[model samples]
Target: MAPATISTPRYLLDQAKRKLTPTPNTIPGMGAVDKRLQEKEWDQFVFAEPPAGSDLKPIMGDSGVPIIGHMIEIFRRGPDYILERYRREGPVYYAESPALSSVLALGPDATQAVFSNRNKDYSQRAWDPVIGPFFEGGLMLLDFEEHMFHRRIMQEAFTRTRLAGYVPHVDSVATKVLANDWVANDPRFLFFPSIKELTLDIASEVFMGHPAGTDKELVTTVNHAFTTTTRAGNAIVRKPVPPLKWWRGIQARKTLENYFLSRIDEKRRSESTDMFSVLCHSADEDGQTFTDAQIVSHMIFLMMAAHDTSTSTMTTMAYHLAANPEWQDRLREESERIGDGPLDIDSLDKLENYDLVINESLRMMTPLPFNFRQAIRDTDLLGYFIPAGTNVVTWPSINHRLPELWTDPEKFDPERFAEPRSEHKKHRYAFAPFGGGAHKCIGMVFGQLEIKTVMHRLLRQYRLELPRPGYQPRYDYGGMPVPIDGMPIVLRPLR
Candidate 1:
């Protein structure tokens, strides 16, 4: 499917041409506005001027096509579409699609401005339209004081002591899943789906404290529900009707709620190692604890976040390692030094080479690429005037590959994250795979440990390579950027 022709209606072309006629004002460091911005209609966002008295420049750019906007091009070209626009329109500009219509904020500067949210102008309500129906009560959906309240309670479960406890369970679950499901010497092993299932199993055991293989059918149902609900974020028709993607998502949300609600009472009554029990028994400084409803809501969101991002990260890392066998061998040697045994938190930390590989992979893909926020009050981003009630999106994946930020941004170089180079340190928000500021991912440490442990086991047991001489993964940007082909690879037994 081709992107809608930008040249149409003589009037639009004329107006676009007029806007390009070298205006007096230009963004600092940007000099004159590029003629590229005039390629699309500026009036689509209805920004006739900046607010009454504000000196901020009127937000500029066009809505692609008519109804669907840039949705087709976005799914077709992925991050490249946004990166091209960023170059043409500069940092702050308008973007529209079936899923969302907002100002696209590119680069670390924009990332810091919104995420820092000093004025409290940005609210999490922007996500209500996208993920609110399904993950309504999830932590990311909450804002300001309410968000902080819930986060304070949630913090108890992710403390260093608690994270250390989870490592053994993650390692054990990964070892068992790899032993049973993966066939050594298999020429066409499906890495994406296989890792997805493995991560889901890990979440079940480590998060819900479910024993391996217990309630097998129910776990499978929950897995399907998560996949459906997450995919619904990109549904063209956002309403629930019949068997459409949006409707399926609504049903899946109900399924997830039911699953979590049914298990809450049991978790609350017992003291256990899993996060569910931890949240149930945990209390804030004032001895406050989550109510049953709060526990259920948090669990559903946490469960989805935990497994989904981990699955994506591990899959991307596996693909990169398979493609670059030298890095895989180098990592294997690092893991071999630790040898075969239960990997503790300290041991996991010792794999410095693995750390660089993981950081580089996250920079390349970043499971959660876009963050959404609505302007509660009028706000200015990099001199662009954004009125109240506008949805603002920050694309971190674009910032990751900005040429100014990293050397040879397109190439895969793990060493950039290592010693003398340390490119990721160029900016505070430069390498935010887990996001930044208050709403950053709560389960980040747990997620990283989970990935490292699983990859360590896989490296010990198998040598990874692509099924063909030159295989590149085609990702479906519709959701969390998954490999559409399931990422097949050859799994050669090492020991």
Candidate 2:
């Protein structure tokens, strides 16, 4: 059976909402969202301009299967499926999913177009299907001026002073996690779950200034909420089907809202150094502040993006280093040269070799595999016409591995990023692990600091090793690409 499609998008979207609408017990204090969902109608927009001229081509590609579309095939084949197709189909091509037909903008050329979305052709709104319900009003979901306005105020939360404050929390937490949480030399210590836990703990501490296990289990609830919401990023079924990922995501959204809203008053009253308090007090020069909605939404997205990417990055660095001990030795040697002391902004930069390895790991794994945008108006990706409302998929994930751009694209080579051998500089958008243009990750600095802080502690203290030296990560690329088995590995103690 095909996944349900909406001919009347507004009406069908409403019906889908009704199916997933929260129950009182399931959603807690989300009666407001329920009210909005029940009463509000989608203000559908259509352009005044006529269709593209006969000269320009329609989007090139394939919409696989009926109903289910490319959903199943994507899961089976992973991103390489699209990569191979891109090689055969050129930089611009079309592909269909259960929800919408989209233009696949591969390689650096089309990728630069979408990321440098100048005329407001692409939108973050298309993500509403995947992330809207969970992270509504999130910075990533807003478009045009509204996105800029919110980003401006939210910028206060990630300022240099704020980031400096966050480093101590990052360093302290990394120490505590390695000491209390990780058992060194465990033959089967899983890297994915362990790193996930560490990053979540780091997220709770560094972002919210809250304890991971304490606060009456605040962190635990937050952890559950992040897991449920992220797991539903591409759930096949949209309905609140019993025992399902989509359903849990809805419930998690409600919990997150309640918890975040409850903290607003307290955060405003006190002067805390955490990002949460910073956001609560954050305002533009015109005295504009995030409504309660924007604060919570931004926090939820920032927390998850930070947690997920940092975890993926650390795990990849660990996996790759374990596989290549010489590279591991090279990095550890630099870490030692920089001293086994706490790293500040200057010291973090001084660990040039460490940065290269981290950069290479990000390139190889490409944490946020694909960044999505929908066309708001007809747009051209390298002369290929993408009609309005088509979901535009751009791949940094696939771009990193393109043979035309990177030398020996599949080899685990960190020196490609080092000194004169800077292969990532071969193309402007060729190595966009953190995305590009105005929509580039706001937390890139913080994410880098967090990754370096954790790895610095671990790398110096241990000679890490994976149980299966040649074990390849089988990525489950739903939202972010994560290893299905949680990346099993064991740590080898240096002392």
Candidate 3:
């Protein structure tokens, strides 16, 4: 498909690129400023008077409560609050958020404009207000040319051959971790925490190639770091006050930086198949490799994104299987038909039912419910004038549950994604769990492989059941969607 015709944010893009292109000694300190000030600057830029004879539609919505805006409501109600407004207003709705008054673009058309970003009018730095505080200098936070430049160098690590090689490692980690660590016989098992740990261990072993059962303390710290960062991204107290989430997140980032930076010299000299090794060595034709700081920065962001999204997805999938035993039985039957445990890339493709279930689960409980961007220039999104610096958000989480898009939007139905009827394909951005366009997730394939491998082992060994019938997981939208109750499930050995 042809990429959208996008325009670069010339001055700002240059400034961002310079920030990321750090000097050898000064690398650690670059891009460390809290973005609250940047957000205020954007408010001024966005809400300023338009040029003469501007025919743009003035943004409309509740200004929200005083200084805090509508964020409290958004935090309390999650995407439902936004969806309720989208229904009342239209696809192009507006609201005053903590960052500023912005537009919420619903449905496929808005998603395409934002995701396709043909005009290069949107800035990925929109994540800066939240994610940048914890994940600055990461590729996801970079915009346009700078993003593409780093992405090109990083692409060498994720080639088809390299990904194929990683599968065995993923399978190995999944098997060892699940079999050894998850033997709880209690009728009520802590599914979220258990799955989180398992996925983190897998991330550690597969992505970093850490020795099995080694570095327990380091892993624990890393796990804590990820949680702290997630909480920081959604923290109500956005300032770095002591004893607050922001302060905790800073400490965690410091811990993570020291660890990753310390390993750079070692990883660069050594040769291995792990992602760290690949990143350490991989470079572009110009021989441009990620600097030590860049490697550590990217690792912190990517690893957190990798493990947390998977945990949320697996938790939701388990909930669905627990609630609907028929689907669970079908999944078990599908596993049996495929012949045995520890599925690889070749055999995994044959597990059609497994794919169906994963798809439906993602649809029912989308991992990344929403994505945001800031307009870098005056742009028109589906006939609505979005001024420069306006915080524009697209709601894929709620979009997946739109009545117009799905036959029974709220119901769990795997067949919707199967056979001649591929519901997600109905719209280009209809089921964008991993996002769409140029900045779509780079680890998309690797995540799927990891999920399948983990599920393959899990289905062979355990018959999963919720502790109680008719149980529904309550998701906390603080970060990604996670079960607030820890998603209790009972696992009985199928063997």
Candidate 4:
């Protein structure tokens, strides 16, 4: 049975026939958006045309409909919307959505242009309005010198030794939690939420140094806090109005702040191997440690990034393996070759098939789909004039699927990542699921180790298949790309 086929939604196919007349009050609290200006064009959202006397081409495209712009199309249509635009326009184009009017940079060269940012023309400040309120002062939101300063300090926590130390804890958590929380031979196990819970538990142990039993009530609250704060990034109404996503996230941020602040002293005083304790003790070359606020912010961001991203990636891996059973069997055989024992970093490296599958899974459905930045000064991307203050969007999701860069780009063949067909090596930024340049994900190594450990345990324990033959799940990209159906699977024990 084949994975479900991709189809463009009817609305998009029929958009040409629809009336262009604006609808009044389609989205609540959109008074701030320039509805009239939105009628001009998406490129015109920033400017009617390129700056006078600049030879660079003007970004092309309309902002979609007024106020909400392309928000509905983006979330509802998933990557299809972006792919359609990529096909219509070249690498550089314009798009508009609530709170974001920007140029979409596609392909490896465009991604490198923005990420390399040689002249320091781009700033991470663009993330401020999106995730900064909740993840404030976290490493991703810092810019230039300050970013280098904190990244250097934070490097202490993710050192090779620290990562190796964290692996045993990850293995143990995966072994215990999967065995304890999951029931094998079940025909309807919800893979997404189930793995979400499992990864959260893993994070609690490996990142916080707390066993699964550590303050269950507090841990649960913290977990929910991380979730809400992340989901708040997509809130249509950006204000902290009661009962809305933004307000709940603001409240969740407070919950996280108090929880971390209360325990910072203990973490600093203790000799613990968890990330929280490590960050407390990690210092830059000059021996400057993070202040209490910096520690709290970093901890919140790391915890959220660790669990949520791993959950998405692991779920995607499970889906691909389930959909393509041959790959599952191959990976299982590779895992089985390792024999039964406590897995370590060296053992993790031996699973070549797993690495290929993981890379392909990441290419197929990257957990963090978009890399965002703000142009701090006028710049040209591939000769397209991008003015200062323009919000810039680049899609790793799009990059991974560019037909020019990838062979049969949409297919599930993981071998493209293996051997002589090393398609990801096509360009420097050709396959950046972890992002690139100075701000590449610091915990990427740890993240991959955690995923492999949990996944290796599962592959060793059971055969994963979709709930029914040819069953395919639809993804909701509201926050990260997650299966809207929770991705139910039937697990048959290998024994």
Candidate whose lDDT is highest = 1
Q: Evaluated with TM-score, which candidate comes out highest?
A: 1
Q: After the best TM-score superposition of candidate 4, give how far the Cα of residue 262 lies from its true spot, in angstroms.
A: 0.8
Residue 345 displacement (Å), model 4: 0.8
Candidate 4's displacement at residue 60, Å, is 2.6
CA lDDT of every candidate: 0.82, 0.76, 0.75, 0.82
User: Total clashes, candidate 2?
Assistant: 5
lDDT string for model 1 (1-495, tens) is: 111111223112223432422122221232232223224443443332476687777766565655767675566557776787777778887765556767888889998999999889888888887888899879998999989999999999999899999999999998998888887677667888888888888888888898767967556888999989999988999889888999999999999889888888898789898999999998889899898888878988998899999899989898899999999999999998999888999999999998899999999998988899888876789888776777889988898998899999989999999989999999988888888889999998888888899999999998888889888988778768888889898898886
* lDDT (10s digit) by residue, model 4, range 139-240: 898889999999999999888888889999999888988777787777778999999888888888887888875768555898888889999988999898
Clashing pairs in 3: 5-118, 6-118, 6-119, 6-120, 7-119
RMSD of each: 6.7, 10.1, 10.3, 7.8
Q: Which of the two candidates, 3 or 4, achieves a greater lDDT against the reference? A: 4
Cα lDDT for residue 41, model 3?
Answer: 24
Off by over 4 Å in 2: 1-53
User: Clash pairs of candidate 1?
Assistant: none
Give per-model TM-scores.
Answer: 0.91, 0.88, 0.87, 0.90
